[model samples]
Target: MTIPLADDVFRAPGVELFDFPPLWEGAPYWLTKPVVLAVGGALVVCALAWAAFARPTLVPRGMQNAGELVYLFVRDQVARPFLGKDAERWMPLLLSLFCLILLWNFIGVVPGLQFPVNAHIAFPIVFALVAYVIKIYLGIRHQGLAGYFKNLMFPPGLPKLLALTLYAPLELLYTFVTAPFTHAVRLFANMFAGHLLLAFFSAAGFWLLHEQPSLVGAPVGVLSVAVAVAMTAFEMFIQFLQAFLFTLLTAMYIGASLHPEH
Candidate 1:
């Protein structure tokens, strides 16, 4: 009699976890799980905002209190240090962006919806593009087109030859190409890796004891579950951090446009 190995009992999760088919027959290509979750995230954000701010009271309570905390966090930690006096003006955009992303990332760990919207490259790319467009528009409007490019590529007080030969080309490349790519990719990569890690441990726990209930496999299965629980908590923290970072970077870009670095 041949004894089965652990590999036979468990199938390791992979990139396949990120892929989803259409919900129903003849459904459009874009109407997959991730897309639906993305829309749901937006609606959830809107509802939260409405609940928190729809009717003001003499003193904040419940959802309003929660919303106020989130608002203050973004305003103080994200917008003000970067945007300064203009922070309030940009709060609506920055707050919405941060909350939407936080919701999307949290959904990855949700029981039924185990997918992060930003894990899909397209979603992050679209958000990054929005920030990029705003940055360019604000830069051009506040500072003339030539002045914006000058500040971006050639910072003030730099020596002429080195600025032209060394810094200018690199800065131009960073501003136009590298910044936006990294902006989206930073969020995408984090969510992708986190979700993949969670799926792997989850599958390991389920498969080890359930599929092949053996003496040796039982302890390992329990350990796998313990690790999954720990990782889930850690992943939640990471999800929140990634959302903050994405929004912080967006604020930085917008701030840089309005007031170029010296």
Candidate 2:
């Protein structure tokens, strides 16, 4: 016989998923789940690369094939179009960026480790800042300091009068201020919101069935679980898309830095 609690016992999920408790009692609060997951993701990616390329081969076998797929995907889809003939020069950087982010995003969907490293905000911000710094440095290197700013602000095909009056300040603000802000926020917002949605439905299911322990709540619990399952699958797609988008934007930014006139 099951003892039934009030239906109100089944409250919806809170932000607890985002607020992680320290895994060890003595550990600093900052040394939490997300940090562990971040390190784990990095190690996993590195190990995969090592295993795939540990032995030189005339033809790829096993993990090498999968590794090659990832390399080609980034090289052809991401680097080629924007970087053009110089795409090969940047392959290593772009590949690392894409794979690291993809793994971090996919961590949220993994069973027993359902956390997105990028959801923490600071992770994405750091990546955006690093890429932004590299972008500015490359721009200044390719085009002198004054030339870089001038080319960025005064795009070709614009009339000189309009370029000086309206476009210069607007371009300055857009390129310098808004671009990197959006770059960071875009990845952060998606992962944060997606994780929240998953947490809500997952908690709802648990609360509906376990907390209240009622026959009446069972159907709702089942439905919530189903929704959570569907959401996880959808989240995987989103993870891939966001990772791809982030890499694509990085390439675009670097391309812009290289050839500001374009």
Candidate 3:
């Protein structure tokens, strides 16, 4: 439940904030803000990537410089740590994931497009499922179908009896069920909660100052605005962190599939 403000008449924003109507009056049910934002974010990411990396200069400047910074960060912090020699091979996927997700998240704070694409569960689910499918496919292809399951469920050094009775079931659950579920939900939950908090404070400030202005309400309204501002800054950091973590986890999943013993 949302924490109601001190006043009873003023309603704090709730789940309704996330309930976006169709973009057009007679549009299909799926044609909503998040859908549009997700597509738009993807295009923007592509455009930026092209602008930055499509051309090269010995002394990089402008977008290329910034792009290199982001690329190097993903390579060093996310891919290299987990993937080792294979990091470059996976940079394309990892870079796209990080850039697309970071843009989707930053869109939440944009004035007109304040909806984060991943705040909707479906967006994250799609991304997570794609990554999950890739991980599974790579595991089976690289380590043969039976070998993949064997390495996953029965890691070496464990007693056969212990592996069969206890470790196997837990490994199966984590590998097939828990991993993908948490992968999507972690991103969804953070964006959902962050956007909700932002909307709540923003609405509260507006309602107090503009909708129901009063001597007492004005100061509270100002405070609410201050909090919203602070949270917006903090949320940007969280947005970047979430993107990094998501990409990192993707690398880790691929690494585990490629080298199960590690």
Per-candidate TM-score against the hidden true structure: 0.95, 0.92, 0.95
Tell me the TM-score of model 3. 0.95
Candidate 1 matches the true fold with a TM-score of 0.95
Q: Lowest lDDT 10-mer window, candidate 3?
A: 1-10
Cα deviation at 242, candidate 1, in Å, is 0.5
Better of 1 and 3 by lDDT: 3
Q: Candidate 1's residue-wise lDDT over 1-262, tens digit each?
A: 0112364645577777777889899999889988999999999999999999999787999999999999999999999999999999999999999999999999988887778899999999999999999999999999998998888777778998999999999988888899999999999999999888888777777777787777998899899889989999999999999999999999999999888862
Q: Rate the local accuracy (lDDT) of all candidates.
A: 0.89, 0.87, 0.91
Candidate 3 C-alpha lDDT tens digits along 15-101: 877888899899999998888999899999999989998889999999999999999999999999999999999999999999999
- Lowest summed lDDT across 10 adjacent residues in model 1 is found at 1-10
Better of 1 and 2 by TM-score: 1
Candidate 1 total steric clashes: 0
Flag regions of model 2 displaced more than 4 Å. Answer: 1-7
User: Over the stretch 1-262, how does candidate 2's per-residue lDDT look in tens digits?
Assistant: 0122345764445455677779999889889889999999999999999988888487998999899999999999999989898899998889989999999999988878888899988899988998899899999999999999879777778998999999999988877889889999999899988988888788777778787657888999899999999999999999999999999999998998887766
Give the 10-residue window scoring lowest on summed lDDT in candidate 2: 1-10
